[model samples]
Target chain A: MPTSFPPPTGDAEAEDTLSTLGEFGLIARLNAGRAQPAGTLLGPGDDAAVVAAPDERVVACTDVLVEGVHFRLDWSAPDQVGRKAAAANLADIAAMGAVPTALLVGLACSRDTPVETLTALVDGLWAEAGVVGVGVVGGDVAASPTLVLSVTALGTLEGRAPVTRAGARPGDVLAICGRVGWSAAGLAVLARGFRSPVAVVGAHRVPDPPYAAGPQAAKAGATSMIDISDGLIADLGHVARASGVLLDVRSRAFDVPARLVDVGAALGVDPLQWVLTGGEDHALAATFSGPLPEGWTEIGTVRAGDPAVLVDGRPYEGPPAGWDHFTR
Target chain B: MPTSFPPPTGDAEAEDTLSTLGEFGLIARLNAGRAQPAGTLLGPGDDAAVVAAPDERVVACTDVLVEGVHFRLDWSAPDQVGRKAAAANLADIAAMGAVPTALLVGLACSRDTPVETLTALVDGLWAEAGVVGVGVVGGDVAASPTLVLSVTALGTLEGRAPVTRAGARPGDVLAICGRVGWSAAGLAVLARGFRSPVAVVGAHRVPDPPYAAGPQAAKAGATSMIDISDGLIADLGHVARASGVLLDVRSRAFDVPARLVDVGAALGVDPLQWVLTGGEDHALAATFSGPLPEGWTEIGTVRAGDPAVLVDGRPYEGPPAGWDHFTR
Candidate 1:
């Protein structure tokens, strides 16, 4: 059913708040105009979705974003929030060497929220879902004081083995499949009101990861993999700890994206800090046993040593430690 | 590291709340003493978790619960919230006729939240996850003004076809696994502050569904199925609408538990209403083409007619309508 709050008219009395849209109305609006993938046996209308994991295995991950903590309403449009939420969760599925297939969203919003905001969030979710040929299979909605989103993504491996963070071994080549520090730069621009770097600020608001590179790396025999939710150094530390091997990252070899380099110059900030300590870039970092796949850039190596991450054979020194949800 | 604020110890300075706990302390407390299931290749300590889904197919579902709406903190313990969150998500997986494999939780809590509250919440999550033979895989923690939990459940089909809500056909038998209405009864007792005949209030706080029944139904070739999350008649209506068949439930044939009958008598509310319209029971309701497997009770039959649900071919009059997150 076309459940949605009527758009507000010039009359102040016609204000369309979330209470007017209600939970079901907002969901109905969200579900409208969405397309399901070919393999989705069941979609949003059911209690749960049945997806075809033909390869006999599935990759799954979840992430939660809270307004003010993860994003600000003044800085991020509802659409951007929706896209970022989906992006963050999907990155994890990709890190496991799988193709994302479906997503389930859990939303909590205040009754005073605008209908347009809710619709924008759904549109963003659908827009991103379409990019990966995935569907928003199901979700839960409830009332809260501020907006909150929890997204869970499910993916298919097409019979490939999962490339976990623990698979890195000494001598494995470390590589990356997307840009680094772009999101951190964007966040910096947003926080500092650097109007000249609007694009960077937007990137910080909504990250776009190279999803296909996950399976590509798997096909190329990636030994260990991780999505960069935390800064590169911090994330690599996870691989080091899990694999019981030392990871040495070569920052100088990272062919920094020209756009980010230009933005860093304009903002008068250290781009390396963004690359090494910025989080939410969602780039795929993995240790491969063979030649790197196309589009994959080799940046480091795994070594026989204590579980730790180092730069040029020593612990990397940067702008303090990377972000921690609680510490921050 | 322990992230959340420490619990209050009745010391004069024990008033430190979630805000004092901040983000990190809350995470540390919530994660304390939790163990991972054997199937988990990687657990909560990482950016994402890897779990076995050897059936080549997975069933996934998610749901979010909000404070002061889904549950009241003043009324329910933090542990209850945690259990209910996991239970509801796992129930959705069960409804898909799959065995739950893992869970990923997302939490947003107020800054004033006490570390002890978060610990209790995590303990509840573990307790419920243990019931379904799964473990908490991974999660995201953030700061918010209210307690919000978003849980996603992953399930394995074990080489069996997934039973969708659309597979019911004319002449199929409708059956139920496990007791229903106990949760509803518990809710009523809690709401009215009335004495309960059994531990029904506990059931309301933490539902214990027949977890194994879902996969068993899949193995036995159930045509259609769904969990009773939103009252029986309302949920069956979904199956009828999806499967294009009418479901005629024979109320007289219902094999309700003795505790419910006793509680209904003590509360002076009709036991049938609780059975028919009570939600959150998390019981599996399925339609089979033939005789049901052992331990299942036949409750109704599918017939060709308008897509509707009836008790003995007539409208089921009850005080409770189905449960809807948005509308309710």
Candidate 2:
């Protein structure tokens, strides 16, 4: 039924922590009283799960979130971490112009973590995948020194050719279909200790990716597509290098939402830096040789030059770098 | 070509370590000179990988290995750990009577890990998956306080219904195909510091699951099957409980390979205990209404009784207990 679980139920928290529940016990609890979608031919508790594939081909991707690096428990709830993990992986499937069908999640955490916290995280995982009409078919739980959430998303292209990053060419127009700096603005509000304007703060914890825009752009003949995960300019740099062409984008063309502007004023920071240099919103950024897709804002044009991302006739040097797991 | 990689080639280990290469640089090294199989519609270096789902349905499973809990880096090399990780996942697919196709790996390690060690792990991952004629389509790497490897395996049923644990009937016969206590014996030798016989130690480091036997059992009309991961008795108890019947077996029926018996004698450990209580050998145990499949050794009989596992008509108790990740 795609139900959601908040913080932790009193009954759940009253139970012994994960160590007392045991691995198998916790897994059984996860499947208890839950119904899977029809696409899940086989659910958890088996050696492997069988998920129906609507196409002869499946798109697969994996992402990992590490404790202290990706999220801090004080900054976000367990559910928010679970949601962001699922959202990031699902966005990759969407970036490939496919609909996500199922997710296989693996979690490793300290034995002291409460069972209620784990259940809340799992609830968040299902709730996020449910938003895209997919299911969590299988997963593994293990003991670790820190909490780690790893997600693998499987999707189908529905007979459409996969839109690769190399398909963009000169004269194609670059467009975006979702917000630019919401999560970054949200992060700033959280990092700078601002309590008001809960929207950005909440978004920093769980990103609302444009799930439908991926397939919609694919249907409308997107030459190349990518999710703005590592900032707009930084992610566009990947397409530019892969397509072997320069991408010239207008700074003003990016829709800087009012929330971001308001947050910037509160923190005395430049909102444009968040718009151009921030990431993790999972917005759809694609290049099209024809008319822009519905609801997409034309942001730039592909040019016949060196492989790079240029903003307003020059290379962007706002943040000095985008997010890198190791470097960060 | 499914070729094996020899330990750290000069070209691979000569590159800068992960600290200097960064995350993207490390990924670029992983994809530097590797060519994917034909079934991989699109390989790594993109948002997600596209794999051929020939049956229009995919069987998925996941397993996680945490250092200090699953393996000790001091006892097992990085390559062995990687091979064991891949082999265990591949075994789950085989247990479902399916052919594994693609694997997505997610790794989290401390920042100080050497690039050479990481590449060796990856090489071993490919070498093991290559044994089953599949490729690693995608993976994620992150900095973690402790090393954790999580693998998700995708397989195809090939028009056969999955051989689940619930299909065992009262009149069915039970059989096993592969070594039963090799890994447990290997662990004993390693813990006791035995040096002469290296076979058990090697087995402990990297399991050799009989991948072909699973499909063969399914083809020969075997009723059900499961991989011997959580000890023979513990795993059989699951099948017995699930099928609502008793599984009675003769202790002598189990083939205690000579190496295990010899190792037990030297350590004063009961060899039968290892055979009945050991796990992680990745051997296949199945039930059949007809004659046993080729190469299968008849070991037990399915009976109409309370759900339990009995050895020689009595309840069997051996090792202190099977592995419980949380408890451990």
Highest-scoring model, DockQ: 2
Candidate 1 lDDT for residue B3: 35
Give the per-residue lDDT digits (tens) of candidate 1, residues B250-287: 99988677888887787798888899999988899999
Show model 2 residue runs off by greater than 4 Å: A1-15, B1-15
Across A155-262, the per-residue lDDT of candidate 1 in tens digits comes to 877777788888999999998988789889888777777654666777887898988998889888999999998789888888998899999988787877777888
After superposing candidate 1 on the true structure, give the runs of residues whose Cα lies further than 4 Å from its correct spot: A1-26, A169-173, A194-196, A254-268, A288-291, A298-305, A312-317, B1-38, B194-198, B219-221, B254-268
Residue range with the least summed lDDT across 10 consecutive positions in model 1 chain A: A1-10
* Candidate 2 C-alpha lDDT tens digits along B185-289: 888888887644789888889899999998999988888788888788888887888788899988889767788888889989988888887888899989999
**C-alpha lDDT of all candidate models, in order:** 0.82, 0.86
Model 2 Cα lDDT, one tens digit per residue, A183-250: 88888877777755888888889999999999989999999999888888889989999999999999
TM for every model, in the order presented, reads 0.88, 0.95
In candidate 2, which residue pairs get closer than 3 Å at backbone N, Cα or C atoms, i.e. clash? none
Docking class of 1: medium
